[model samples]
Target: MQRGGRVDGATLANLAGRDGGSGWGLKAVRDVHQGHRLITLPSGCHLTYGANDDPRLLALIDKVPSELWGAKLALQLIAQRLQGGESQFASYIAELPKGFPGIPMFFPRTALDMIDYPPCSQQVKKRCKWLYEFSTDVLAKLPGSPEDPFGGVAVDINALGWALAAVSSRAFRTRGPTHPAAMLPLIDMANHTFSPNAEVLPLEGGGGAVGLFARRAIAEGEPLLLSYGKLSNDFLFMDYGFIVEDNPYDTVQLRFDVNLLQAGALVSNVSDALGAPLDLAPRTWQLQLLAELGLVGPAANPELNIGGGGPGAEVLDGRLLAAARVMVARAESEVAGRGVERLCAVDRPLGRDNELAALRTVGGVLAFALSNFVTTLEQDKALLVGQAVAVPQPGGAGERQLQPPASEDEMLAVRFRLEKKKILSRALQRVGALSQAAAGNAELKQTAGSAAAKKGSKPSPATSKGFGSKKP
Candidate 1:
């Protein structure tokens, strides 16, 4: 071990051999710490869990209404499956109708996911860093963990959510795109302390792995802390519920991990099924669909079952995040159209043939798509960052590649690749939106065509290009 001490658990069973720790990268944990992790035995190194690890964690998981033993078992299986290799089991349990009990009072998020933690307090981030340092410093001084079959990080969460907080996350192994260096479940468990005490930034490569660090002085017994990364200001707001920012502001961290993306898809399906019959317009329904899709809220995330189905690929396929792009563009188009219509209503002149003019149609499809697609571009770029960090697929998987590893050399590589991908995907996304533009043009043609169809009718040859791209 290090030099200071180690803490062992005395309660419940030690599921994962009552070992030091049992998430993904157990090897790294050992290598990094040299066997002196300083923490106690968790009854088991579960890949995922149901409600709690043991009865002591809270009242009783057995008593909880849901049948979750199966899931808990699955978590253990994933751990065993990926044991010695880089694999993590991400899971959760949310029974509280409102919110669970407090988390700080328990083991801390050091073992959970970051998105699960509070809004990521500035102080927590600082304190968490100090705690991690403390954990390392105490390595030698502490005694070996008590050999309790049921003693591990699994059962510390209290009846009130305060005892422990778990963050849902994607699995990472050293071999995959989410290498151990980049995906630190250990750090992830700690959550975002916000004080900058601990940070895990991408390594020197333009798109390589990440580097974990301590932001402050550490103690001898405190838990090691980590971050969830910078998020958009609205964070997961657009996914979970209805909270839109007047002015777009970004959070220092990303709101959801790849896990949320999956959850959102499920939620959207459910919400649309239930809410679709309410007789709402597509736009109104589309906004509601965002929450179902997990773009709005925090709790919308689901428990990640290891081996059940790994975090879906990072949506590198422009098509995967396409609907989001289309929706955002459409919204923007609507607004722009309104403005144009105001101008048009004032009897603006369009005296020439084959000439472009503003539209009077307020909710024209093309205008909406343009706006929606424009907003989605930022989300797409941001998501690209997440996708870049996601599991890599084959080169032939799609039209583009994830930005190459984030390296100094790779940055240029990434820049070039990104430029090409942007051109391709943007053009693709734009072309996809063109259907709406076609509709808008047709509306104009109908109005203008009516005039032309009557007299001096030389049907203006339909143009294939956009008003924006035309050489004025």
Candidate 2:
């Protein structure tokens, strides 16, 4: 606290036996009121790429890609770590975790494979590979000259990995987007929670001091928490080395492929008159409409999302919903002149039959995703509780005995996939309900038409309305 830093009613301590335990955390020493300032550190305590003033260090930093800001800061951290007692922040550097066992980059092959979700798994591998190459190919080859930043110290993959993990998990970009990210001393000790009790803010007058304030009243011994972001499990696990239970921000991603939609439509019983599989090949108008929505053409984004948190969150991305509806539409009259916004609204069903087809098609997509997982949601839950579950071997081989996760990494992987499965299952249930309701409504309309014919009255034809319709 001597370096122009202040701590009020809070103390750093080892947070054992708490949620995701065995980490250092800041805890309230006494009752603190809401909006109270709890901690403050002057600009000198902020560690950033610009903190190291050595000409050689700054020159070397310029070699790193601008987008790899984490790596650039990691280089600064490594230089300080090498300085040891000579460094101004030696005490803080020493307190930094020697190894990050929780990060997926450090997980064993078996534990990594347990993640199962390709999007996260592939990213983990890519980062790991880049670290290896950058360490050996770039840092290791630096010339031992006057410009040598590390003073000829051989930086290996292990050292670089440690530095990278430290920066990724703790650094914050408080000084706007244009400024490099900074690591705040003592301020970074706060653990993360979606519902944070405290928050980090800039001190008044903008003198470059960072302050932490209570967002709500804090009881004595309450752990001070800060929200990392509204991130999914993939980000939380990959970057922070932990996952929140029932995270509302979590989403399952799928590529927007017409073939997948075709399979979904077929499985949901959408077919042609000759009993052939439903054709999802977009016609000229449908393609134009999709292109207008940024789902087709060279610049189109194929990524689609589902299962977001909170009551107001959409279960399906609007673009994905619109595409599904447009693809299932067999006639131009069904969707002609309808604004893209109108087609995307969940409340605005095209027709009873059309709505059922669209809902069921999306359901088929989710079902296929769920089938890719080795264990069901129930099985995953059972495994988490220490129950042994049997899983099928590859290639239709006989089932093999699977035991409960033996390591924290493996357990996290299981938890991650489990949440994803829950999201898919929940989405499926919602669409299933919609499909059933639409079918029932269609049946009722058919019954009503039969009654009107028996009464010797011709039933009026239903007029399909598009956006901006006006009555005669």
Candidate 3:
């Protein structure tokens, strides 16, 4: 690795080895200022797609389909590792971790079933299943048996998983390079942090090296960090075998069945302003509403806030508000074709009550979904304080030993849940208030109507009629 910029006394080593280094990491010998170059990986030293000159590897790659291109690269890496000193990637391969810890592929069935989040667990299962399929269908078709190093055996699912994880965590999508994605040597050693102190920039001009420059000042002996972009915990765990505690960018997805919503619309008294009930099926109606708001399918995940204008604002999200409007309009029998702008207007011509009612319904739904996941903060705090699980003793002993403190995974899980819980709880309370305001307004109107009816029914002292009746 060559120093790309004015890097002063920086070296690559197992920075995390003391704490159980997962692999190689970079460290600073002296204090490095912001913008100081840490390392540069020369072009020839890196591995990119379609760069392997080996005829056998290229032939194998040609046989593999484009969709499974990543798998082909993984197989190539394994083949080179088997080649030892003769392989071009010997040094880089040696530095990589033996196996990626916490990758779902390596997880046992029992462990897989233990994942708290259903989405994450489902994803893990899907990935593992796909990998197994590729191994059987694709690898089995290749020449030679399991004993052959350069042939089929090199594509073992387990070995390929290691390569997959390494490439995923380390590779960069470079523009000026021959391959779509390339793996840099020293540049890949930097660990990920949400807030990074350095950035990996592709060197401008036609040169091959990519520069790792300090984004900010780094104290001596501090490990350099890079951002892997903002990612949620579920994705992070699935892809990187780890989760960030209380990630600000994290959110719990709430999925709704369009069919169910449509079914409700059919039987419900809710209708548009014309007083006609929804003509379409509940699912179709939901789609129409979402289509109006441009939230068809995957676009449905809206950033929820306690109160929202936009993402960081105090007002609620516009998309959510629009959805609430549609629900209210349908319930109140409001007119069709009213867009989001009209619905969200402060002085909307009509359907004000409908908006409030919608807010209540939507808020209730969100709260219920949020409450189902994660333990209460109090419960989490108690667990963190001191929770123990009994484990069977060795040699078939009857007694069970209590292990102090929860596992790291459990701790991280609770912490992540606690953060999400806070957001959900706050938003629930706001929605509740909005609902109550709507209810209170309806009650006030009912009381006023009653008083007016009573006054109208009362006799006008029988004065005018008495004039004619008394005279007769």
Better of 1 and 3 by lDDT: 3
What TM-score against the true fold does each predicted structure earn?
0.22, 0.89, 0.70
TM-score of 3: 0.70
Which 10-residue window of candidate 3 scores lowest in summed lDDT? 447-456
Local distance difference test, each candidate: 0.27, 0.77, 0.55
Q: Per-residue lDDT of 384-472 in model 1, one digit per residue for the tens? A: 36453332244535433333233322222222222222333433344334334545554343222111111122222212111111000
2 or 3: which has the higher TM-score? Answer: 2
Ranking by lDDT: 2, 3, 1
* Ranking 1 against 2 by lDDT, winner: 2
Off by over 4 Å in 1: 1-186, 190-198, 201-211, 214-472
Q: Largest lDDT belongs to which candidate? A: 2
RMSD in Å for all candidates? 21.9, 8.8, 15.2
Stretches > 4 Å off in candidate 3? 2-8, 13-24, 51-72, 145-154, 176-179, 258-287, 295-320, 330-352, 374-381, 388-423, 429-472
Worst lDDT 10-window in candidate 1? 463-472
Pick the TM-score winner: 2
Candidate 2 clash pair list: none
